[model samples]
Target chain A: MHPTSDKFIPFITPETRHFWEGTKLGELRIQKCDSCGHKYFPPRPFCPKCSSKDISLVLCSGEAKLYSYVISHLPAPGFKPPFSIAVVELLEGPRLMSNVIGCPQTPSSLLLDMPLAVVYEKLSDEIILPLFKPTEKIV
Target chain B: MKNQKLVVIGAAETTSLGDIPHLSQVQLHADGALNALADAGLKISDVDGIATAGENPITIAQYLGIHPEWIDGTSVGGCSFMMHIRHSLSAITSGLCKTILITHGESGKSRIPPPEWPWPPRPGSYEGQFEAPFGTMGPPDLLTIPFLRYMEDYNITVEDLAMVPVIQREWAALNPKAWFKEPITVQDVLDSKMIAYPFTLFMCCPRTDGGGALVITTEERAKDLPGKEVYVLGAGESGETMLISQMQDFTTSRAFKTSANRAFLEAGIEREDVDHLMLYDAFAHLPIYGLEDLGFCERGEAPNFIRDRNTAPGGRLPVNTNGGGLSYMHSGMYGMYAMQESIRQVRKVAAAQVPDVKISVAHGIGGMFSASGTVIFSNQPN
Candidate 1:
């Protein structure tokens, strides 16, 4: 059996290195298209909306709303059972998949459209992951 | 081209379904192809075009001692075989090939695991960089994202979603070959172990080992064949964004609407004209989304429509009569099973046949609402 841990280390690329490093410094980095002013997640070189190559990295406020979420009871590699996997819509208008770390992984606790804030977890010296927690603790 | 009607001369699933540990994936393909050939009374030499998913068409051809003039390997997840039927129709109509064989086989349950690829996604790849890192592994994980939102947006309760499987199990009870023949109640579904939140064990399709094949040809050739001729009245396919998060709307599938609308328009019929439907039910939410997206019911009304038992056996619209993927055999891709059920219903040989079923529409979704294909079949010539 593979070792199961709660941390998942992502591969760093030239396009995503800045975003991962931003997490290390406790900043949520996203890309904004200079031409279309469209902000997006999972850092890319060009704008997915307008197909413009003129893009710049902008530090996000790290505030998001829980668009939707799932409490995964199945065992996944490097993750414990019953963890909440969420798709959070950032205030800037892009949605990204992450784990909700602070709240209980239950439907009653993880309400839809609940406000969340980004929190960084340093998995290793080279990787720092950005996960979400409720703005205030929810019972 | 509207007058150029294609027909399915033969369709057959593997000799046995669910937990066939002896056959390899390619062998399952051969099993389905040979069964379909026998069903059509045709030989390997009669097949001029071949299409398959999960396995390479060239390898299937080479293994089955077949050489084809036309081949399609459009692997867009579970709906690939549906797309194959649409593509095969065009190929046969254009004189690209005479006899087309579409095969589907998957060793989803019993196959030996292939060696893992050493390299992960390229740093810049969208899935590698964005989705996979967050432990977004497979359909169960990815599809739940949209489904959760859909439930919240529409005020759909978990009980409403459970009704989909409950009603499907009723149809499965009548199907002798259905993997889960015993009936289940809505409470049974809600109590089933949770795989993902809002998706219990019963709400998800079970992994099985099986294969299916379809033999298609021009209407003229179908007339010469002895089997009940199920005409391909219309066919349409479309795709949207690949990732679940990138979808334009979480409440509905744009691909399902586009593909099904095109199919209905091409068939020159409205939703009321159809007597039967086979919306792929890999997950319970698919049919809910499909019913609404395909215009069977209004948006946010699918849960009610299903809850009212409109899709159950003996209902106004009989859906998944051969027990859907929820209760039937789902060998990875489920489009072929849905296609087989539609053909059976049209031929009037289904285990739970609907009365006076003239037009049956089969719709398929692939890659978590990423791609869609809709094929409408009828017993009457259009």
Candidate 2:
């Protein structure tokens, strides 16, 4: 894996350490409430839906649908131009922001509601970002 | 709060707008405060309350030589000033303060030294952890990502989206104070340089330097003031998410709906009652979302409403009559400017003043739909 510290990195906090650890292990982890069976993203301590502390980390199917996106013409630090910044709706019913890889970054190529699967890119030893790509597999 | 009447007795932008490399961020706040105070025919000593965002209230109070009994530092985002207005209304009605001065100033383009923080938020913060890691550059990137989904779901074409700025530019051409006064067409918008997909350079607000302020007092005191009183008929504010990606729905703004609905309920007015409007336009899509979420049009119909010239110069509802943040002058926090235009319309002194505008609604978005605030103003006391 190539070490890329130039990119933005998440400061691992106690609450978010589990999700990051899961990402490093190739598992997409989100919080699910045991009390209300609610699922949420970005790794909060409690369930957003039920405000329940009775929550646990659940593995995502790593399958998703392209909910929305924008292609950047401006340059950023780690990414090249014309890359798509997307929010993918996971099969588990929560949406998260990621880049869509393995496809051309254009309106014609990145179809809305198209099936996508997750692919993790190792940013650094501690950080692995979840990106997505178009898939032919029926969802 | 409803029993008593609170009115904006004084309002003014900085003495000069557009570019002021000389005025530091805090200095812009002081200038706006002083000008608004002058407009109200009062001295700094007359102000008993102070509220500001983008700069600390404590700092601004000391800088303006005001010993405020009440202070607010509600720094939500650009719309923080709108929240300040809402809070000031409550504070004045509660007798927490007698006179409130809300100030907003930003050296967004100038980037003056000190009190300014570093960009690309540090790690350990929520945004740094989740949002920043994705290589999002700024509001133009993050705030605009959701539009594609909205377009797909609503079956809106790119041509429909271009009309928002086109109509707003028409309003801009009439206002001499506006930054971009040149008229532009939908094809012009499409022909401009693309900054982000589906968003061209012309569609985004210019990074300009400016500031604005407002002075609020009860109607009883306003009678002795120097300017026409624009009464705060009703006001409401709400927050949706800290991150744009977390917004509940891409097609509409829950925060805009919740805030404006509360304002309408409090004002006791319907959509038809409002003759003028100022929907913040940091990006072209905001007015589109604002129209739908604020209940001016049905969901997914705002594009056509705008394209049909319903919001244009001769349109039924004159929106963004000040050219808005898009062309007017967005100096970082645009909520102040939005409210200023509403007050100007209600005062009948606007550059493109709509005839018989008894009521005007100013709606603003804080940070990438993170928070929202709506204020309904009326020339009539009732």
Candidate 3:
């Protein structure tokens, strides 16, 4: 069968299945090192700082801040030109790449250090992505 | 190892610089390896060790039909060549191998088939799971994202960032092999087509097909060769994170700082002692980060230092004299080309030669500030 073009699909792994599941459930999930109390993004089984296998999956506050970003003028498959590709810093002390939707993708509109909240995007039956959006309400 | 002196006996790029559609990727590696061996006045049979990145060392060795005792296929990213240099020093000094050859080549612009990696990565890989869903395809998207945070924190203007390519173009204007040789202005960089925010097309390195190689050996052996010897005084390699967002800080690359510091310490040279510098410029912001992270300037000072013409032509520190990745040719892996320019400067034969360059530093970043390698070359070993 011929596959569809202009679509972004993320692969789910055994270690990361929980992350996709949480996103589909409208929850933002992150990994935490139970030994060191260090929260990290982009799920891995072991702790980055302490190398502790004593890690747990926890629901995040869904709160973040716009740490950095760039509005791409060049077109990418499944993305419109001039959309923000950003790094959002979670309040739990981990940062991840995401898009700032529900706002103009402009430098003036997307201010640095601005408060953000997680919004899930269901790409397919198997994958769900956690995106970000600006918010005035404090967590 | 400290007592043993190591030198680069051979250095050369592919026969042609850019726009070679006929050569396959692996063939490009062979072309560069062959040219570098020729420059050293040696044959492939004369080599006892092989090290390469991008292409597998085993493939490269078998392709050249040389069986070696030491092989390093350390593939991190563009900076893999730098790490290869660091490893080759250890292998040669420890008597593991003599006459080590490090090569690099890529069909970046040609789109040669085979070994093609799918976009968005596979579902199970870390990058595929995290970065790809965000539309981060290549360097322009992912690498340039961090600059805005740096600029905001440092209060640097877009005009200051534009000066990086402008000054490098001045150097490229002197070098005949550079891809973009025309001298441009800050206005011109701003006016060029924008690829990503804070990064115009002029600010990004051009995608072109090219390759370069280096032959390293003991100083005693290099003396027998016809080429001038560029001694490897010190080298360092460091890694941070594969994920760009996981980087400790957006403003500074921890890997860059760690690698550069280790290199400078081992070289026993102060920043002022460096006669020339080659900070890989995959994007305009890279050199800025290099200037500060490498300790050439203080935090939040590189933009102004560059704007003040400190790193430009006739400035105190001559940087990217071979036009760098931005103006010089940027194959997929750029570290080899960066090292070639440093070797040329130390040899006193560079197209845009820095006068009396006794010491030179080549710093490279791999995979979006994820990894770094720094090498120091000198005409004299202390």
Best by TM-score: 2
- Fraction of the reference Cα-Cα interface contacts (below 8 Å) that each candidate reproduces: 0.63, 0.90, 0.86
In model 3, chain B matches the true chain B with a TM-score of 0.98
Q: Cα RMSD (Å) between model 3 and the true structure?
A: 2.1
Q: Is 1 or 2 the stronger prediction by DockQ?
A: 2
Model 3 chain B: ten consecutive residues of lowest lDDT = B111-120
The runs of at least 3 residues in candidate 1 whose Cα sits more than 4 Å from the true structure, single-residue gaps closed, are A1-8, B112-124
Model 1 lDDT per residue over B1-382, tens place: 4767888888999999999989888888999999998888789999989999888899999988889999999988788887898898788878899998999988877863431221244534666666665666677877767898989888989999999999999999999999999989889999999999989999999989999999998878877777677888888899997667778888999999999999998889999999999999989999999899999898899999998888987689988898899998898789999999999998999999999999999999988789999999999986
Error of 1 at B307 (Å): 1.1
Measured against the true two-chain complex, the DockQ scores of the candidates, in the order shown, are 0.57, 0.82, 0.78
Order of all candidates by lDDT, from best down to worst?
A: 2, 3, 1
> Of 1 and 2, which scores higher on TM-score?
2
Per-residue alpha-carbon lDDT of candidate 2 for residues B51-115, written as tens digits (9 for 90 to 100): 99887899999998999999999998888988998999889999999999999888888877443
Return the lDDT, model 1, position B300: 97
Q: Write the per-residue lDDT of candidate 3 for residues B164-248, one digit (tens) a residue.
A: 9999999999999999998899999999998899799999998789788899999989888887788899998999988888888
The backbone clash count of each candidate, in order, is 1, 0, 1
